[model samples]
Target: MSDPVIICCAITGSVPRKSDNPAVPVTVAEQIESSHEAFEAGASIIHAHVRNDDETPTSDPDRFAALKEGLERHCPGVIVQLSTGGRSGAGRERGGMIPLRPDMCSLSVGSNNFPTRVYENPPDLVDWLSAEMAAHGVVPEIECFDLSHLFQAAALHADGRLPQRPYCQFVMGVRNAMPADRVAFDAMLTTKRHLFGDAPWCAAGIGRHQLELNEWAIAAGGHART
Candidate 1:
């Protein structure tokens, strides 16, 4: 296929720490440096999450602004997608960075079981985040952690809550959430095709399933998140 694949580099996640790998970018400077490297390495998008001095995740917009500025200066046309995931913040605070007007931001349409607890994305919060994204002209990358989420995205799109063409990302291998199964992956593709037709989509696999899911998504003609 001649279609260009958009590679998204998640510089640092909320859960992983320096203690986990010693290479996780914690500070804003470190995140910028890592994002620059990823941009140079052919990643067209930077999936970012800001952390405090204590290496804990925060929803501080200032930190996101610094990271966004650095990425725009260093990476130029690279897409900056800030994480609105629950681990970074709670309630509306999770979308505090939306006003910064990043190129894109992740939006989880529904809740699912995380490793230890529920990754809650209530209807109200999801709607609020969607509105924030719309107000800021920031595109929402719908994170689908379960089959129901795909339908939820469809409903949101139908109601004009999500103005964009619903860019969904399937997240697999989380403890009590979806697993990295080939059959399930194919089913998701089928459902996406039936619901959204040829609209662009992506996938991410947590922990050990990352590379496997990347390959699977690429081979299936979908974007892969690394």
Candidate 2:
């Protein structure tokens, strides 16, 4: 038998907006409400991204603090995993919330191409972000868009940057990044096991591939993100 699946619910991402879908929560309060619903439905982790008043992504620590407070109050033991994705901000701005000491923060160890632009996570920035997370005693959920990211995570761990057995999240089906192909997914899973050795991992897919990746990860006895 496999370990039980851990459901991570991304309440609002960096790209979507109320205009894109009014259901997308923009305010701190709205996010809490949405996250509570997900918690009730079986999501143990809330992968969060906050926004400015105009519905644009912002890496404001105050907003993240507020969201963390509300989620803890409403959802009890739900894990608050804040995103440090490049879309939220530039350079170190993306890691502003790390000091707030959420249970985990999304860490992309390598850079990759997004739909229209390069998602830059330069070595210096990655080192800074990882060091900050280490200093704050926060765990990092490595966001692996490409296979190289897994190896990078291993290197960081070996060098005393990342915590032991860092949780990983495989992101797939993003235009120029890894596709939602089963072969690639299997290779990623195999590589993760080869490098990390039974460390917990999850899979998330973009847009239409979301459900497919969720099914694949769970069926493979790993984890899923919705």
lDDT of each: 0.94, 0.93
lDDT for 205 (candidate 1): 96
Best by TM-score: 1
What are the clashing pairs of model 1?
Answer: none
Per-residue C-alpha lDDT of model 2 across residues 111-167, encoded as one tens digit per residue: 999999898999999999999999998899999999999999999999888867778
Please provide, for model 1 over 39-106, each residue's C-alpha lDDT reduced to its tens digit, 9 standing for 90 to 100: 99999999999999899999999999999999999999999999999998999999999999999999
**Candidate 1 all-Cα RMSD:** 0.7
| TM-score to true structure, per model | 0.99, 0.98
